[model samples]
Target: MIVDHRIYTCHPGKLAAFVKLYEEAAWPLQQKYLKNCLGWFTTTEGELNTVVHLWGYDSLADRDAKRGAMAADPAWGEYLAKSASMGLLQKQENRICKPAPHYEAYTKAKG
Candidate 1:
């Protein structure tokens, strides 16, 4: 399995707006395409105004296909426009990861 993890840093004082936008606009649309949304979170310490989310995919091809579909959706476009207009985010980072050897078994078991 593959994990697509994202960290989004919001513009100062915009964290609530960013989170609200995703909750109200993006989450429902994303759910239509992404099968396994592991979790969504916001930081309470250390990095303020940061949000993190994780998506699980069967493979890189699966990830690409799902994301591509989402990108093509008009609702996704609307969400993008809303975010862009609000300028809620300062920056974002992405990471693709696989479970470690020892953790692979546990991951599979949980799945």
Candidate 2:
């Protein structure tokens, strides 16, 4: 599986608002278009106002298609606008990753 990780640094004091909008508005829209969307979460420790979410895809093509589908959805567009209006995030970073051979071992050890 492929994992698309998005790291968002929100403006100070806006983390709660961002999370509310993400859960109430954006996540539902994402659910409609992205069947492989694993989940969305935020960092509570090291980076205080950082959001990290992951989407799982069968392949690169599947990811592209799902994103396109989401973009085309009217509800998703509305949700995006609403979510964006909630707060201005300071920085955004996106990374696409595949599980490495040692990933399982690392996760097991961490667990």
Q: Compare the candidates by TM-score and give the number of the best one.
A: 1
Looking at model 1, the pairs that clash are none
Give lDDT: candidate 1, residue 58.
91
10 residues in a row with least lDDT, candidate 2: 79-88
How much is 37 displaced in model 2, in angstroms?
A: 3.2
* lDDT, candidate 2, 22-88, per-residue tens: 7887788788888666767778789889998889988889999999988998877887687677655
lDDT per residue (tens digit) for residues 1-111 in model 1: 899999999988999989889999999988889969999999999999999999999999999999999999999999999999999999999999988988998867888
> Candidate 2 regions off by >4 Å?
101-111
State the lDDT at 31 in candidate 2. Answer: 82
Lowest summed lDDT across 10 adjacent residues in model 1 is found at 102-111
TM-score of 2: 0.82
